[model samples]
Target chain A: MIFDTQRAIAWINRIAELVRADVERLTTLDTAIGDGDHGANLDRGMTAAVDALAEKEPETPGKVLITAGRGLVSKTGGASGPLYGSGFRAAGKAMRDEGDVVALSDALEAMLRAIEELGGAHHEDKTMVDAFAPAVAAFQQAAGATADMHTAAVAAAEAAEAGLAATVPLQARKGRASYLGPRSVGHEDPGAASTVLIFRALADVTAE
Target chain B: MSSSANGGPTPPSVGIVLISHSAALARAAAEMAAALAGPEVTIRPAGGTDDGSMGTSIDLIGTAVREADSGGGVLVLMDMGSSVLTAKTLLEDLDDDDAPAVRLADAPFLEGAVAAAVLASTGADLQTVAESAEQAWSMRKL
Candidate 1:
């Protein structure tokens, strides 16, 4: 089954709920390495995104994502705002109106590249790219192997989790956390943690 | 361009936008920059989220950019962190045909805004205003 507009809307709504539940956790992680606003920023952004989707009821999965992205940029109020917002818009524009498994794979990569372009974060920089890049790679590999949306989503989520875990041992090379140098090594990057949540939300929605 | 009946070749003033993470800070800086410059020049403060919290808002920045441009290009000066990213995102969205082209000035926020404002008040072009703002970094106090 294709991941249609409803599925995409469900994914964002799920992300909003997940972010709301994990706000304190995200905030704690950010506080350890960055400005301590990750949780609140994402929560507010995702919540607004969900509202936007409901109001606009975009005709296609891509339009839904673009609308959600606009909401995030307008309300997230942090670095993640533009980073994640731009990623979603790029992904949406790449997908256009299509929502096939192949489109999903391409959209994931597009989102990853957009984030990299916006934040200048690369793999192993202990930012969201750590989680996002691996997730896209995993999804692409899985989709190329099976062309199954659920399988690809699961693989992406697990890869994102592993990437998030790896960030705990890394010295941040970018973002506000980089200001801390080696002192940032012990904490998991908040951006990576949020990326994990994002993939997990996708996997959960795909499973449904 | 038609010259004013009385004034001689009066060029349109370049617009200035100040972006910061803090709402109060950006407004205060705008106030200072405007004071240094004349009141006729438009200097806008695009700061904080819509709900009055810390962090830059893309919507706010977009609106400020649109409002700042007075047929003369707008010069944007941003504080550190996401303010730069937010402004950059908006700038990327601007097309070549967009009216009153916008340029981001990579200079100190307060000092750059002050310098840019002063120069803009002189009816300088966008490039010159941007250069003046960027050059403000060299004005280090010994």
Candidate 2:
């Protein structure tokens, strides 16, 4: 059985809340090289998107994500905004027609398209793409092998975290970290770090 | 919290808009807002893309603003640079009834989210809430 709109919303909410609790830490990392609002900006964007959804309460998962995508697009004014927005928009597109279950492949395709269309960045670019790419690929592979969304989500979350950790030694090519050159090497990509949080939320929610 | 849908006597509930250049930032912002905002206020985020050609489409953003405003005012927050232009475009796209009085938030991210939520919870108008957010952001060192 696949999770539906309400479950998805709950997952998003949990992720948002977890990130909110850590906004200060995230921004501190951003403060080192970037504008320092990474955590604050993301927190604001997610909060706003959730509020919009609560007010409108779209009946379907597609509508919910679409509403969220639009909200993120307008509210977040940084590099990550459109990428995340487009990702949800892609996910929404895939889930436009729903049954009892949402296929892992459909979710993967939508998220990949969203990242590609919005950021124009690729895997191993030392951005969130680093984490997202690995997570999606792992999720797809796991899902293909087994029809368990919960297991797939958990595997993806782990892969995402591992990918995020791997970014520590990689050279920066995207976002503000690119400007820092060698200085960007040791620090974790904030975007990748946050994506892991999101995937973890999804996994936890599904497990429940 | 009690909120009035457009044209009500109570100070209209504030609406939130987030503008960022990063998809991760946008996602993170949306996640933050949900944690802080109460049930009455409406928050929406618009993410920017890295491609110079790609941006938050004004029409699409305006629709969200209009929908959230519901005859109230909207407080828009942007990360930097082009986000200002993007917010302006979104405001221009609003229809008469759909468009609420649009205010640009001063506080960057956390500060803005907190201020917006406080004002929204208290039934502050878009302009006042936005002004407060700006003050909070401007005074901040980082």
Best by DockQ: 1
Tens-place lDDT digits, model 2, residues A1-208: 5567787677668778878988987888778766786786678668878888888787877777777876766566565666776677678767744523335457666887767655656766688889988888888877777767888888899999999999889878776677888888887888888888888987888785
Superposed Cα deviation of residue A98, candidate 1 (Å) = 3.9
Best by TM-score: 1
Q: What is the lDDT of residue A83 in candidate 2?
A: 71
lDDT (Cα, tens digit) per residue for candidate 1, span A117-161? 988877798999999999999999999999989899999999999
Q: How close is candidate 2 to the true structure, as a TM-score?
A: 0.61
Q: In angstroms, how far off is B9's CA in candidate 1?
A: 4.9
The per-residue C-alpha lDDT of model 1 at residue B92 equals 70
Clashing pairs in 1: none
Task: Fill in the DockQ of model 1.
Answer: 0.81
Against the hidden reference, what TM-scores do the models get? 0.95, 0.61
